[model samples]
Target: MCAEALALLRQQEPWFVSLAILGALYVAAVAYRLLHTSGLALCLRGPKDLRRRYGAWAVVTGPTSGIGRSMALELARRGLNLVLVGRDPGALQDIAGTASDTHGVLTKTVQFDFSLVSTPQGEEAMGRLRQAVERLEVGVLVNNAGVATPHATYLHEADAEAWVRMIRVNLWAVTEVTAAVLPGMVERGRGAVVNIGSGAAEALPSYPLYSVYAATKRYVSQFSRSLCVEYRGKGIDVQCQAPLYVDTKMVTNMVTRGGLLSRLIMPTSDAYAGAAARWIGHRRPVCMPNLGHRLQWCLCHFVPDRALAAHRLRENLRQRAVFQLLRSSSGEGIGGRR
Candidate 1:
């Protein structure tokens, strides 16, 4: 009976066999992604569990606003005392107060501008930052601080000072701060490092107008992956959290103009933070907190790179036009007032 069944199958069709094999492979790939790659595998741990796994304290840079602020608050909720780092002392104090009051967790603030890297002031700030994290038992270091171009433009057209500042904040800060905190984590033999990257790093083919920003984020993802490989058995989980977008002032008008679909797809910072929290101790080298972003990443691979690049270029061109119009209108209004 088995021989007869095999004979009948072999007699049937070659295309059918090929299609069946392809279908099986696709199913397996999907299962692996769901079980290991995506956040679906992440099991959210409570404060007690988190403390046991990571440590008592977590340090978050850019904690004054946006995703940084939300992640800091969420960490506090999970019972980890916080060391909040940001440029605004007032904003830092406010978040510290809220975290302490709401979660009954101790909080400390470190106010320093990352864009000052080329100056004596930057050196002084780095000294202070080093001192801030030295004595504390820092379990998790959230390298969330970053900057982007104010207006989309080619490298030549971009403001020279702003371009340099973006590099200092986005790339320099991550490297310096991580180097400062990593030694302690290594010595302790258990910790987590969460580098907040952008989907610009890998989700699309190429980011044209935002070249510097994309390059910096690519650095972050690579840095995280290499660190994870180097420190795996030592009990340190270095992972990059790269999300597409969240409603935050950093994005300005682009995020605000989105309708209901945008609101749902690109979540608010707080919502994104909550979802991101699930991967705190997750072992993956990267995490896309939003499901929409995960799907976008997967879909981008199916399209041609040139097509994706073309689409991005067109979108960026539209944005540049709109921004120029707004600037000109504002200038005209000011002249009229004069």
Candidate 2:
């Protein structure tokens, strides 16, 4: 049977060659993506001389927890001094210490509540941040602060205050901070700004349940692309990193902690930060850093908007059910729609 099949394949020489070529190309592409996602390319080349390429000081907002904390550490590990900005002075100091704050010129802290932007108190905080960052050779800025509706909830049912908070942290704060930092970079002729975005907006064709969160993230993606174009000539690298289902406090409703599937698909904040950090000065203006996420992104593109939206609705409903069951049993510990 094997000999007969081999003989038949040989007779169709052109088709066989074409199929073989296509298979080879497919394998090669997959291999390339795997290498890219694993961050092996960065390892092989070694760390960039970040101090030379960008500057000595890097500013990170919301550096107290989640992706922000991990990113601050990664940058510190790579030899960039840090200015850690967040809501809690104590938490900011705590994260800074973990990043080796005792050492000379390693870290500083700014206490600013991004949710208060444009208020009188917010202006004072912004002025303090400006003072902290402007005099330094601030090379890289990571706008990582963000918020979501507490859980899966309809826009109508969602708290109006929550929408304002999301817009402030996700969109307005990013704009204000970038404005504060960009001038010094332009004067010095180089810097990199990294904005953390959500896959809710970038990967999915439509995200109905969490409409405001998705819209804010969409703004992040657009802002990053437009800023990159506007500043490319001035030696600045602006990037928006769109991550999907990172195992952070924010995604408690979406991922079951420590489950096999969650372990495979959802990168912990530290794991994501390590991979995401390597791509900071890279050329891609907007990108998904995880291999699984990149695959998910490709799949989402082929799916129609209506179907994806329906699927999201279903998932939201399912999660809400889980929340109810757990909450009833455990007395409000379970995450639920706000």
Candidate 3:
């Protein structure tokens, strides 16, 4: 029996050794590719003509705060004149002033509530934006305005009106705004449209409250890709920047009492802005800011649904525990129940 076992082990040893070698080579190749194919490299290799063609004028929606504000600032730094759009006239003025003073670039402010646009009032607001763009020799459009409601247990239990509002803001506004500007871009034969999207488009399950928001963002991603395909030959670039939880007022409020999963995944608005600038400059179709986010999304595409759900449940519980600990340290009770 012992002799037979030794023979079996000897036969399997060569096969095991070959498998190990093959795995090592595969890992080395992947590592090499990662080190070489960075975001910066992609940007550097993009069309030099793109920069020369886009000119100075750019239109950015939701420029008062978060990633939109950052993108507007970044573009200004690159010498692009801006048409800054937002809800509050005062906030828009402040941002426009800052950009003008700091970047020494021309800035225009258009105040319109994206949430109110389905009504006559909304149409009026969009009219203001359209008029503002027509006067400016705008060459780039950043479709960045969006909103998400607080988390609810289930779709039926959620506020239907609020969900519809999210859809209108997150998806409809993008479509309308893009449509407004696209003909001019297409006729000009050179332009770029950068659409801001959420990582939830990958269908991550932790933020059950954001189901409608996620679905809307998925539309943004898919539509952006399709638009790119349609216009690629016409010299129009449509790109999507799908970032994870950004450090902004909206995210801060969402995760203020949120679970541990939120803490682990949340990134700063600055990160999103920087990455998006790179994506916009390069005209990449899709850009996920961080490597961890990229990995999670890639895995989501390949993992089994049941296994993914189990992992998400565990992550949610872990996030909840961390939130509880932070609350307790601040002399608050668990579950934020007080």
Candidate 4:
């Protein structure tokens, strides 16, 4: 056996050497790509650099909480003034005040709900938003306002109104808000639009129970890609940052029920905001800033879609059970966003 193996090795020596060379080339290519990406991150490290590239004023939708709040604060810390939009007037005012005092930047709060954009109420809000931004040198627009289903719900189980509201918040708002801001970015000749997406769309092969939410995010990712190609020549940078779970009210209930592995994988909203802010002006059209999320995205290519979907269904069912239990216990609001 040893002599036979020795003869085989000798016969295949040239192929072995060629394989070694190919492996070395692949490693070198990967290293070079990583280095290039790091260099871009360092060069465009927000603060004054971002202010110069995009302008000094930014408009961030849904600036009152979670990732939206953190992104607004991060940008303000980088020297850009802010125009904050949210559904809650009081919360919007509070955020505006805090941003100004803490970051020492000017802030204007636009009180509007993205869910109402197709109605008469939305018209009044739209007019207000236009007036607020028309004269400013708005450099960055963060389309961060979004929603998920109140709980893990199947499409058939979800009410028509519920799905409509989700569509408005998750899909319609992203499109209309970008439309509202893109013309201004074009006129200015330089700007960034950062849309917040989810790992349900980018990192996973299939999301079972959260199908509609994932579908909406998939659209956002594609929209961002097309927008990048369309506006790159016009000096507009379009990016969709797809993060996995983050420590936010939207998933507070679900993650709590999702066990230690789930908790460990989630980034704090502040941490995610920092990465998202740093990567905005980089040329990546669709990206996941969290390292864990990026790893999961790579693994997904090797995973069978049916298996992934089954695993996701189990996770969602657990979340659904927990949410139902909590709602029944208190007959009141739980820890997640509706």
RMSD of 3: 8.3
Which sections of candidate 1 miss by over 4 Å? Answer: 1-26, 43-48, 255-260, 330-338
C-alpha lDDT (0 to 100) for residue 218 of candidate 1: 93
lDDT of 4 by residue, 1-338 (tens): 99996677677879896887699899999887765543444445533478988999999998889999999999999999999999999998998898999999999989888888888998898889988998898999998988885578778876788778778888888888888888888998999999888889987888877788899899999999999999999999999988888888888766653566664478788887877777777788998876656666767879888888889999999988887888799996453332
Off by over 4 Å in 3: 1-40, 43-51, 203-207, 253-265, 281-283, 298-304, 311-338
TM-score-superior candidate, 1 or 2: 1
**If ranked by TM-score, best first, what sequence of candidates would result?**
4, 1, 2, 3
Q: TM-score of predicted model 4?
A: 0.88
| TM-scores, all models, native as reference | 0.87, 0.84, 0.76, 0.88
- Candidate lDDT (C-alpha), each: 0.82, 0.84, 0.73, 0.83
lDDT of 1 by residue, 316-336 (tens): 887677667877878731110
Lowest-sum lDDT 10-residue window in model 3: 329-338
lDDT by residue (tens digit), candidate 2, 1-338: 99996777778879777898699899999999877755567678776777779999999998887888888888888888999999989998898888885444588899999989988989999999999987899999999998875455677776688789778888999999999999999999999999999888888877766778889999999999999999999999999999998877777756567776665578788888878877888888898877667778878879888898889889878876766676688886432111
User: Once model 4 is optimally superposed onto the true structure by TM-score, how far is the C-alpha of residue 118 displaced, in angstroms?
Assistant: 1.1
lDDT of 2 at 334: 39
Across residues 1-338, which tens digit of lDDT does each residue of candidate 3 receive?
A: 99996676677878886787699899999887665434546555643433367756889998888878888887887788999888889988998999999999999888877777688988998888888777556678998888865343357765678777777888988998898888777777878998888776654654453467778888999999899889989888888878776677555433443455553466566666656665664556777755446656766768777777776556545654564565668885322100
Q: What is the number of backbone collisions in each predicted candidate, taken in the order shown?
A: 0, 0, 6, 0
* Candidate 4 Cα lDDT to native: 0.83
